[model samples]
Target: MEKEQKKNKKPAFVAVKGIYEIMPAEFPWWDRFLEVAEGVSKFYNFERIETGIVENADLFLRSAGGEGTDVHKEMFFIKSNKDKWVLRPEATASVARAYIEYGFSRLQQPVKLFYFGPMFRHENPQAGRYREFRQFGVEIIGGENDPVFDAQAISLASRILKEIGFKDVVVEVNSIGCRVCQPAIKKKIQKYYRTNIKKVCRDCQTRIDVNPFRVFDCKREECQEVKKAAPVFLDLVCSNCQKHLKDVLEYLEELSISYELNNNLVRGLDYYDRTVFEIFVEAGSKGEKKEENASKLAVGGGGRYDYLIEMIGGRPTAGVGFSFGVERIIEIMKKKEIKIPAQKNKYKSVFFVHVGEVAKKRSLKLVEELRKNGVGVIEGLSKDSFAKQLKMADKGGAEVAVILGQREVFEESVIIKNLKTGIQETVPVEKMAEEVKRHIK
Candidate 1:
């Protein structure tokens, strides 16, 4: 009876509500995405950089701004003895912190960096949004505040999405100007909202007083209606901001990347300034007429944050970067039924199947030898049955299966089976690695 109770006891723990595990089956898709991202990063000559996952809470509050931003509210705080730390809500602020601590400014102008990691956000879980999700981002920091960098960042992001099989990509870009012109634009928006305050939501009412630019970011039905007639930032931007935006647009045109001028698209973050852009993918083919009212979900976005470094205690530096939600990208791929082929190293395409304890021991030594010889090999040594082991090899898509049995082990030889041709041959132990390569060819 006691034994029965022990067997029936329920699990004492479960995964946290919004957190998830990436199982082995889903690794191929992730590996393929990272391969493409790395390839793009290499082509652009961006160095990979990683920052700590936990940081001072003030880092985000200062860089992302006060209560008006989502990042500030969604941050997960922790108490470490006397010091307060927060799981990094985003990478931009952390990267900026690194730039300051490492004195990256002393190295080179416009130091290019890329990162891939998980970010924590305490938000409502949805299709693509999660409490914890992976992000792939790039940052170009220091140097002159060139509009060309803006266009280059967008181009790199677009190229990554295209390479990952996203079709009908669209970039919506806008400029909110720098501190010089943004104040005037904010006043115009503030005045407009003050007049239509009754028609707007409670959130927009507060947004008008704190961050008027965020008024346009509201999605409330009533607020959207009121925002339709709200003042536009493009018309109020100073001449420098105007020319900067114009140059960015022209550079994008030269790259042949299509874009829509969305004057109302103010990104939800506080650090953004001057040019901001978001990348979206149409649900279907380009031939299908897209509805003007049809909403395109944004998979990735970023913009210039010229003041963020200074805000995070670094010297004033021009910075531009973009981050893509890895989960969202994978979700879109699955919805489109896009199949990612398993990434098999050509040299490691051989699978080893062994039967009985003697063969299993011999197979382990043989596999290590093959690896030492620069041959990639896979094996199911833990699996005892020969049939089950062969099935696993087939499932792994191995080009050839190296089979060994007690009899073959005793004879100091192995069997090389061509999985595709259904042909088998016996090769001596000393020549097995060479024979496997020949079979692969």
Candidate 2:
């Protein structure tokens, strides 16, 4: 029985598919990011929402457009009893579904909601792209198709990033235009690409037929050559779209926000429209001491989605939101040597070290009592040595350790060892929990 138990306890030698451990040391950084995200959301009057990861596959297939978009092509599909479910590639569709399902429209004019959690996809893990990753997203569902909400939505994301202690980040904006002009512009651009397809890369060639706008998003060197003559989507914007684009820019300027009109900033997904923007920082730029060489790293993006709610069977409603890749942000923060305080509070208490089996058994219950009284308690019940357990308590940042032994237990008392002071005192067993809490503070 002991041998089998030991074998079962063996450490795992291989990590599971697309899954990685979030070590305890790294948790403080994640907690800091979450805290900042919550603070910014609260300041903006955005409520929090948590939707399940498993969603119907068609919701994405339709929301992401049929065949060519990133979500449709790179998603992980799971087979259930009779239907196919998918890990949500992103959160906007799920947020839209939540808004429709819960009848949130009745509460307020534009229901602002924020969510931070792990979103999944099956993709080659690179620096920024991961199979399983965390996204901090916010959605504004409701209100007229106003560009003010569009500017506000993007600004909310920028504000959240700014509060997270990042500098040198630029807000890049573009108007993909509304439904009236979006397709017409894509068709016009495709006509130019149709003639230039032979000169572009193979993927760009296929993109010309299915998703004509994405052809301009090519990152290949050979494709860049063909892009010199590719028609810009903004060149064909209709009158209303042209006016909306101009107004959005005016609003941004009113906010004292600096932005560059990147006409080529088409988002990867099909759901985006009219207002599309990305936030990036140039590494090695002045005023960016915290993140050296973190230049042009795409931190977050968002746009308007007035047609998405109606596409999913809900009444026509304008929706817009942005999401931040938490892991990628953390990666950049680490490379820049940026610091987030881990242990904000001082050590509250210490471990109970046991010298014998009986002492170990009795100390477990006492440790629980300390914890119940709002005290942080550390323990090493498996350890047989008093020295090793005391060392562990010190490493746990415990200010004191409660020593339990045969004599102390029989006398209905325990010895308290102050780790920092090296002072010891025997206290009555009944007062053990209370005294430890008092002394640690």
Steric clashes per prediction:
1, 4
Instruction: Report the lDDT tens digits of candidate 1 across residue range 343-410.
Output: 65656678988888888888889999888877778788888888888888888788888888999999
lDDT of each: 0.86, 0.80
Error of 1 at 282 (Å): 1.7
- The CA lDDT at 89 in model 1 is 88
Clash count, predicted structure 2: 4
Against the true structure, candidate 2 reaches a TM-score of 0.87
The candidate scoring highest on TM-score is 1
Candidate 2 stretches greater than 4 Å from native: 1-13, 68-70, 228-235, 254-256, 282-294, 345-347
Query: What are the per-residue Cα lDDT tens digits for candidate 2 across 135-176?
Result: 999999898878888788777877777777776667888888
What TM-score would each prediction reach against the true structure? 0.92, 0.87
Error of 2 at 30 (Å): 2.2
Residue pairs of candidate 2 with colliding backbone atoms? 281-296, 282-295, 283-294, 283-295
RMSD of each: 3.8, 4.3
